[model samples]
Target: MADIAGRAGVSLATVDRVINRRKGVKERTRQQVLEAALALGFLGADEMARFRDRREANIVFLLPAGTNPYLRDLGDHLRQRVALREEGSPKVRCFFIEGFNAPALAEAIRRNADWADGIAFFAIDHPAVREAVAEVAANGVRLVTVVSDLGHSGCDAYVGHENRSVGRTAGLLIGRFIAERQGAVALVAGSRHYRAHSEREAGFLSIQEEMFPHLRLVGMREGHDDSGQNYRHTIALLDQNPDLRGIYNVGGSSGGVARALAERGRSDVAFIGHGLTKDTRNALVEGVMDAVFHTDPETLIDRAIGAICQPERQVLPMKLEIVFRENLP
Candidate 1:
């Protein structure tokens, strides 16, 4: 107890309170003592059992609701991972917000702040959401931003792919595939409000300007990650630019672009997109999309759970995986 108190920078009384699960110890201090105790291997079986038998943490996950098959599958994967966990793990609850509205997301966070031990969400980069995250963190709730990050929002951790790397990888593939083509390429995005999307667009444009100067960049459009909007955007791009040869979808709704291309008999256009869902896989097999970039949601959920429960550890970025028709699972 004395060693743990010294290592954790707390008094022995505080350490005793933390170890015995007594009241009046702050969450951060409790975590520090726990980490120190674990590191020193000082916890006996009885102490360990007492820790494990504590009340389960109530964790709330906020996801976007719509036709985004990727997010839909990701939400399902998170739920399943929680369900299959061993006893004594945190209790996870998921909520899907409509239309990626910032206010709606903020409301969800505020509503759960009183009861939830930890809150994780696919963040929309907006002032309201950032303020909400800061507020919750100030109130002693652990916060994690997943998939898309809220920059400098004081969240405890971020669990997702390095989005810029994902874009650079996509750009390299698109650049190589379109080396011999003599036409402009179009870029479609869900929204610039997402730091992930903007970072991806920046990386893609940088690669194109640096390596693929021969292929012109026609323009970029916001599809809002909706298929109908993406369909209209694709049609407009195709109509305006008769020499368009490739498209890089930096966000969701790849299926809409595929449908538009098929309808216009433009299968020859090189389509590169993100997310390896049923829609993207079908598009790849049918020769509509050339490649898809993805990351495992199960890995993301596991890492997020670790970050929430074991706040002393660091949360690392997830690896980006690219899939083609030949490697489709």
Candidate 2:
């Protein structure tokens, strides 16, 4: 047992757990122990091979299917990373359902509960989704909410920023960039159902009312995180409010906002939004977008995986990064 432990780079207790088929040992460590035992002639080759067939843990991601560049990139990055791993590690599967479909999202959560040991996804704050999250967490499944958080829904961790903070930052930047010019500022959101967007909208509104009393806040519009809808909204907002001085998008519709600004020849208007995507990056470089914010996809995924592995560990909110034309990394 000690020889196997030394060979496997594990403690004697772990070797004992693997040898006795105990529940606590991780799959990779268990496999290593079995390999060492086989090398030492303590177990038959066939036996070790048979035991190796068992998988460690199953993790599933239920991401929203959307045209939002940031979310699409995040999902793609996650899929690519998970595909390159060895056989014994946790197997991650990603499924895309329609964005903001409460029933479909709830159903997906419940459907995967029996099989997935850990589940990560974009969260909606609807009651049905909350109930489903509660059920899964109660069953000991680790749950992490990615970009849009629903931590109050009993999710184990949230893998995104404190959205209200992001909003306040946006508000501050937009307000200062326009620099005491008195005109209407408009807000565009991805969806009303997403709590993150709502929180961001609230934060921006609060700061705008508190500090920028000189500016009038036009009513907000929901863009559904779709570029086309966002473009239309921005065009109308600009046409109606010829005095519009700035725009704050509480969602990922930076592309639409930029396009609208260009079409209306309002590039001089201060625009602030989320995601440091190609469109937004170019906008920043060209001075079309005043500022944009983002979080690293790899960091978010790593934080979520840690929470999933430990189950009870506390996962901190992922950091938010603000980008400007001068600091375009």
Candidate 3:
């Protein structure tokens, strides 16, 4: 910082304000100081803030937008932790951006490259997104994939379940719930773009084929992680297949599925899916849905933050929680 102040021909206080993103630094001066820091391999306000040197740790969370239950849970828990600042806090700052628009997300990642010490994204598997992750890695940012994954992208750690195994578990759970019933079972997924959802569907199909040969997997509907669309498509499919005995939702839009089921007065169908949000808990208690494959998003975020703060420590692997009416906690 002394070197930066001297090199920029600015006072130490001026350099501090600009580098810390504190108010009162002129925009031009801020830019100049930032450019000087970048040029000199000096940390930005966000990175330096993580230090008791009053360093701020800027960690960006890139995820799909909308009323996504899982991301909402994750964001809420992380923010609560940020508020408490009681344990392992690192001058935290977060950015929530839409997970689609690969280029836009990539650009955001790149823009924060110098400012952020680490990044956790629900990665989309496009080349641009991978390249952006790579760029962050190259910039020496601690990188992690959360919820959905970017498996081959050289992420420092993944803070979600073994996706394929969880999917297989979802499949087996759904397969059994519909085994004695008649008619083909339908599956609704958040998006084919997400590795997690796809793996869940695969696990589901594998188990369904192996155990419930009588129950057919009719096909899958793509809901694009939108609640309205998930509801609409679920309703449409229910209408088309009156004999549809089951529905397995493998992503955050499980609430929409419950709504569609309730609207059609066919909550009798064995509807089971993922996530244990308030909606799913209510549905399970009312017997509207059978069960949910739950994950503790709060723990996921905590471990993620820990991984960022101490990359050398082995953050524990996430567990797949199965939530039933009797065990909805």
Candidate 4:
């Protein structure tokens, strides 16, 4: 108890009061104590009992499950929070749904409607999905979108990179690297079902057409964020466009692309894309990829937690990091 109090920066009596739900403790102080207990894993039976009696605040996080490091890292952070047990702690849960299946996602949301206090998720652009989110909002549950914006859908706030800006960064990097070469540039994405991928591709192309007119974008290929699809598509694209000089991964399968490039001795291509997962890191180190625009997944999780705790602490804008072999952090 003393160690918990020390870690929580509160007195033992205050900790006891919080654990036992004694009267007169401010909400802020109580929350701090509870969060400390959660982070430190020093929760007690009394805290568990008090948690059961409180109005269970549930925060459900929905994201597409795949091999993408960014998504995996975010999911891992959420899972850690869900593992914590503390009085009055918001019960955090995560759902890994199929790619942009609006009906399926909505059904999950609807089924948990009664208990959900807030929902933080990646935005899906389908009309049914928007309507479902609208239904949740109508029912008074706070909804937040991460890594993709759903501002038009009346979401509480978005916690991610500006998709267009992320794309422009990729464009500038690819364009600057290839210079005025007449070689074709390729864009591989997850799926058009995702707003982020589409927006990124649009932004990348907009810059390519306007500023780097000489750099031809061959076409945007959908990887569905799958390894096998990315590998197969990359091999075929390379074969079809032997003169392709640059590649940009708007989303997904960057690792698979690295493997394909390395196998075919095509590492000379200026590759730029998203995330800094283990595989992406390896690619950068081995010179198979030129650069990566990473939006920190841990920071996204922290922002989600902050929004849940203090809804007024305006969600911070996500940073689009430019990671090259020279500056691989």
Candidate 5:
């Protein structure tokens, strides 16, 4: 204890509290002491035995199911990371919810509350979802919102990028890329139910109104994060507004939008979308898509695990990355 305290620049009492999992110690202090103890080999055989004897934590991840490459890749990456964990680590299980509607997501949370020590999900900001999150939290399960957030829903923390900033960046890029600033620009989203999507749309519109006054937002549509739906919507938007100068896709189905633009021989139109998956990468390479905004899924999962296991710890905002054809890795 003395060695740990000295190494961490804290008192012996603080080290004692952290090792015993006692409350009142600030999370940063606790982490410092824990790291010091591990580095100095202060946790002896007895301490290791005590830790091993404690009840195993069960963390459940509720992810969306579909052909959306980003979500699919996130789920796959998390599963692989959890599977590769060494023995004695917490058990991590992932469940995919179909359609990603509020009711289905709510029910999944309710059902998992009985078994999950921690719950993480891509949230829809709806009353039913909030109620479900509150109920799970009341049952003593730690909640972490990932990718999308449910505001004030008793969640312990959020682990994702600043979505509104991502939207504003997209809007600014599209505005600068468009040749004719006076023409109409279209916006496509997955669903208004997702706070991330709505926030992105709001940011995009705000920047367009403030900086690009001549660019008119002619149409907005929900693609449900489905490629087929996005393709259809893009086709309709082009048909209705033949003079459209740009398209901003604030959702997962950028491939569909790229396909639609290609079919209509409208590759000249400024196209901006989210995610850097194979589909979007190919589109960017083929000059069918302009820019893509993305973040590392592996980093997201790491922060989510920290948020779940150490409920008192704070999760820092994820960095948003923009990928272009010239910077393909």
Candidate 6:
């Protein structure tokens, strides 16, 4: 009740009057209160589902406007769904926001909350984003964190892989693949704002320490998921470390890494990354990249929709499928 009132910019008494079916509140005010209630996940699962059924449900997907192919694929998948959506089905919409801007993402979340029945967004580990999510939750809005996470913010669900585990798998693959893992392994990422990347890095480091203690992990270059930046970073990594044994990217732009390896004629360097995009698939096939972790965009979208329309269901963490050069399929 307090959450709703605060979010709605109304009084506690007004929220009480509106929620309790009292007659004193203005219709617009009452609606505002209700919207807030819904945005913040204050509504029960049944109530949330009914709310979706009562009217045209609006689902907004806010993704990073970055160069990451996987994020683009996710947006494309959503847009395609939106274009082909049937009558009475939930209306799906997507927006690409600045990848690293937490304040901007938070603003988008709040703005979308005003009218969106449900919102799914690429989450970052930022205070502003987390606060926005908390506010949305307080408003009773169903929110599904996509890709990365906002960590413990009261989101309705999360629709992505276990990032840290994926990272560990990458480490395991790269460490094991480079049988003579006596040299440094290049560590690169899209950005630390993405909790996924950081978590993956942590997991990778843990594995390296536990299993591949002989190899030194080096250079966490923030590519911001931009291929050009990643390319430059990889080039720099290569120029600096002649004995680079492996490369593991916790974020996107595996293409850049592969190109750098090719240009440097470093096929001996075991390369591993996330996402199974066209470029990554080709890289795997060509043996430029040793392995990659991938999860289908369709699964992510399906889970996001399910969480929005039927939020009561148990939301499990999605698994990442490891794709190796030998197993291109």
TM-score per model over all chains: 0.85, 0.82, 0.80, 0.80, 0.83, 0.84
Q: CA shift at 205, candidate 3, in angstroms? A: 1.1
* TM match of model 2 to true structure: 0.82
Evaluated against the true structure, the overall lDDT of model 4 is 0.79
Each candidate structure's count of clashing pairs:
0, 0, 7, 0, 0, 17
Higher-ranked by lDDT: 2 or 5: 5
lDDT of 5 at 95: 92
Which segments of candidate 1 are over 4 A away from where they belong?
Answer: 1-26, 31-54, 81-86
Query: Which is the better candidate, 2 or 3, if ranked by TM-score?
Result: 2
Where is model 6 poorest over a 10-residue stretch in terms of lDDT? 19-28
RMSD of each: 4.7, 7.2, 7.5, 10.1, 7.1, 6.5
Q: In terms of lDDT, which candidate is stronger, 3 or 6?
A: 6
Per-residue lDDT, model 6, residue 271, is 89
Per-residue alpha-carbon lDDT of model 5 for 154-246, expressed as tens digits?
898999878888889988999899844578999999988889999999999999998898988975799989999999999999999988889
Worst 10 residues of 2 by lDDT: 21-30
- Residue runs of model 6 more than 4 Å from their true location after superposition: 1-53
Clashes of 6: 17
- The 10 consecutive residues of candidate 5 with the worst lDDT sum are 21-30
Tell me the tens digit of each residue's lDDT in model 6 across 3-41: 788899998988886666543343456678778988898
- 195 in model 5: Cα distance from truth in Å? 0.4
Q: For model 4, how does the per-residue alpha-carbon lDDT over 167-276 read when each residue is reduced to its tens digit?
A: 88889888998887778899898887788888888889888888999876788888888777888878988999998999998886589899899999997789987788
Native-to-model Cα distance after best TM-score fit, residue 178 in candidate 2, in Å: 0.9
What's the lDDT for candidate 2? Answer: 0.84
* RMSD value for candidate 5: 7.1
Per-residue lDDT tens digits for candidate 3, residues 1-329, read: 98888778878998887766554343456567766776688965666444224344567666666677767777787777668874435656566777566787788778776666787777777888899887678545778887777778978888888877786776677667666876878889877778888888888888887878888677899887677988998888888887888888887768888888887888778887877888888789878889888778767777777777667788555877788888766
Off by over 4 Å in 5: 1-56
CA lDDT of every candidate = 0.85, 0.84, 0.76, 0.79, 0.85, 0.84
Candidate 6 matches the true fold with a TM-score of: 0.84
How displaced is residue 86 in candidate 5, in Å? 1.5
Stretches of candidate 2 off by over 4 Å are 1-55
Looking at candidate 3, the ten consecutive residues that score lowest on lDDT are: 48-57
Model 3 ranges off by over 4 Å: 1-57, 86-88
